[model samples]
Target: MPAPERIPSRGLTDTELLTLLAEGRLTVLGQVRGASNAVLHCTVAYEGEERTCVYKPVAGEQPLWDFPDGTLAQREVAAYEVSEATGWGLVPPTVLRDGPYGQGMCQLWIETPGGGTEPSLLALVESEEPGEGWKAVGFAEVGEGRTALLVHADDPRLRRLAVLDAVINNGDRKGGHLLPAPGGRLYGIDHGVTFNADDKLRTLLWGWAGEPLTSEAVEALGLLAAELAPGAALATRLAELITRAEVEALRGRVAGLRTAGRHPEPSGAWPAIPWPPV
Candidate 1:
C-alpha cells in the first residue's frame, strides 16, 4: 500500500516529525552515493511545506553475514530512540516508515553549515602538515605513494559523539557520518550498522582513548541504562525492532561504560579505525 495522501504540516517539532514521517508521502529527490545501501535524498511534504530527509529502503539492503537482513532500517530508528531517551540528542529525529519504494528509515535532514551565507561551522579537509588546533587521528595512504594526515575538528561535540558511539556499540562510525550543524552541534548519521551483540565498534574518534569521561557523559550513560531496564519503554520499543539478545547486549555495554568511567580503549582484537577513515 502507498503512504497516506495527506500528512500533517511540515511545521512539526522534533517530536511531531516522527509521527509525520511514519505516515507522510515520501518523494525521492536523488540517490546519496557511497552508501552501502540504497540511500535516497528525499523530500517529505505535507500541507504545502516540505523538509529534506534521507531515506534508506530495506529492500535495497545488501545481505550481510553478520547482521540480519531487513533490520538495518529498524536499527536506525532504534539509535534515534536511544539518543532521545538519554537526553543526548546526538542523532537527528528518525523513524521507520513506508516510503515511495517500501519500508525504510527516514531521518530529518540538517543543513550543513557554510552551504551558503552561513559561516562554516565545520570542515573536513586533509593537509600535508598536521597543524595545531587539529588532532591527527590516523594516517591514510593517499595515491601517488604519499601519506596524508587525517585530522578532525578538535571540538567538544566530536567528543560527545565518541561517547555516544561507545554506548551504542556502533560498528561503523566513519568520518563522513559526522555532520557539524550550527552552534557547534554535531549530528551523527548512518546508524544502520549498530547495536550488535558482539564488539564491532569501529570508529575514527580514537583521540580520547584512556581519557576520563566527563561527569555529564557518565550521567547520560546512567540514563541509558535506566531506559533499558526490564519493562522500560526503550526496551519494549527495541524488542519490536531487534532480537532479545541484542537488547541484553546493549544493556551490558551501558553497564560496562559506567564501570569504566573513562573513554574506551581499543581492545586490539579488531581494527581500531575503519577503512577509508574519512
Candidate 2:
C-alpha cells in the first residue's frame, strides 16, 4: 500500500492548513481507490509540521438510502463551511477532526499540477457548438454509436464552481470532483453529497445554466446572505456541520440566489447531469 507521498500544502496558511487539518498526527497514507467512502491517504502531523490529507472515516461511511446514517462525515464538514462562505476558495481546507478511522472528514491535500497534464476543465466536443471558450454540457455517449459535445471550461474557475454548486445543494458534482490546482487554482472535492434539504443539485457545473449571476456571483451571494443569518459565524459553523433542515436549506439557497439574479434553470426535478459525466 505505498503511493501516497505528494504532500505539498502549497506552503501552508489557510490558518496553517486549518491547523494542520485540525491538530494533526493522522498517518494512514493509503486507501483512496475510487472512493465511495473510507478515503484515507493520510499524513497530517503537528507542532513539527507535516502535510498531505484527505481522511473521510466516520467509520468509513456508506449508508445513503437518501443520506442519513452516519451523516457522510458531517456532509464533508458542511462542504467546507460552504466553501469558506463563498469568498471562493472553492473548498479544500475542510476539518471535522479525530482521525485514524474515527470521526471523519479531514481534507487539505490539493497538489495537482503537471501530473494531470493540465488544460482540462473537462471537454469532449466533436462539435455541436461548444466553441469560443466552451460551455455546453449535454450530448455525451462517445462509443460506437457516437455523440459528443459535453463541454465545460468557460473558466472564471468554472464560474465560481457553478456558484458553489448553487450554494451547496450539490449532490454529486463528479468529473472526478474537479481539482486543478497550482496557480490556476480550482479545487471542489467530494462534498459527501452536500447539504441536502432536498433538490439535490447533481452537477458537472452546468456551465452557468441560466446565466447572469456574476457581479462576482452577486457579491458572493451578498456575502452569503449575511453569513447565513440567524446568529451568524456562518450560522454558527453551519450548526456544527449541517441539518437544522440542512442549515435552513442552506439559507434558502442563498435566498434563492438572491431572488434569482439568474444562473439556475434545471430543476426538472434533479439529475441535471452527473453519471460519469467526465
Candidate 3:
C-alpha cells in the first residue's frame, strides 16, 4: 500500500491535532530513551495534515506490581482528560489508540515555538547559592565528581502542576516530565503511573510544600470537583479509562486538597520523591 501524505506541523490547530491523533496514520520515527517500557516518537498523518507524537503501546509497557497491567496507556489519556476538564492545559494532547505497536497512548509532541529550547525546571548549580527566581532542592554530583546544587524554578505554573499532581495521585512526577514550552507554558508527560487507589503522589515539586495554594489554583480545584459530578461528561470519560475506585480516589483527593487549602507536606506514607530527581 502507498504511504500516507504528510502535512505541515505548524499548521494544525489543537482540535485538528486531536482528530489526527485519533485517525492519523502513525509511522514510527524512532524510540525515545527512558527507563520504562518502549516509547516511540512518530509522525501522525491524516487528511493532508501530519504531526509528531509520542506513542506508548500497551504491549511495550513493563509490568508493575502496584498498577494493573495493560492500563498505563489508558491512564495517560485519563491524565490528559483531567487536564482538559480542569482547564489546566498542563498535559499535552493525548489519545488512546491502536498504533503500529498495538494499543497505546499517542500524544502530540509539543514543539518549542520558533525552535527555541526551554530548559528543564531543575537547574544544576556548583557551590553557588541559589539566586532569585530559584530554590535549592538538593545536591547532585557533576562532572569529575564535583558536587552541585540542584534547584527548581519558582514559577506559578509549576505550583499549578503541583496541585494537579495531588489531585491525580500521580505516582511518578519526575523533573524530566516537566517540559517548559514556548511563551512560558509548561507541559507534563509520562503519566502512565497515575491515579492509583492508594496515595502515591511522589514528586520533586516540594518548593511549594506547606504553602497556601493560590486563589486561582483553589478555584481550579473547585472546577475539577464540580466536573466530577455523578453523570458529568468528565466523570463518564474518566470511567472509561480508569477503575471506579480510582475515580473515587480522584474525587477524594480533590476534596481533601480543597479542604486543606495549602500545599501538602509529605505524609511519610510513601517515598516523598521519585528517584533520579531530574
> Which portions of model 3 show Cα errors greater than 4 Å?
1-11, 113-120, 125-130, 139-149
Name the Cα RMSD for model 1: 6.1
The CA-based lDDT of model 2 is what? 0.78
The regions of model 1 sitting more than 4 angstroms off are 1-11, 114-132, 143-148
Top candidate by TM-score: 3
Q: Tell me which of candidates 2 and 3 scores higher on lDDT.
A: 3
Taken over the whole model, the C-alpha lDDT of each candidate is 0.77, 0.78, 0.82
Model 1, range 1-278, lDDT digits (tens) per residue? 11112223235676567766666678888998887799999988766557888999898888888897338999898888888776768888889888888888999887766542222223334676547666556677768987776666566667778888887788888767877666556688988888888888888887678888888788888888888999998899999887888899999988988998888988888788887655
lDDT leader: 3
Query: Tens digits of per-residue lDDT for model 3 on 5-102?
Result: 22234777668878999999999989988657999999999998877899989989888999973389999999999987767788888999998889
* Segments in model 2 whose C-alpha atoms lie over 4 Å from true places: 1-20, 24-45, 52-93, 97-106, 115-121, 124-126, 129-136, 139-148, 152-177, 180-193, 200-202, 205-240, 244-278
Q: Which scores greater on TM-score, model 1 or model 2?
A: 1
Best first by TM-score, ranked: 3, 1, 2
Candidate 2 Cα deviation (angstroms), residue 16: 16
The full ranking of all candidates by lDDT, starting with the best, is: 3, 2, 1
**lDDT string, candidate 2, 3-42, tens digits:** 1122345476678878878888899979988776789888
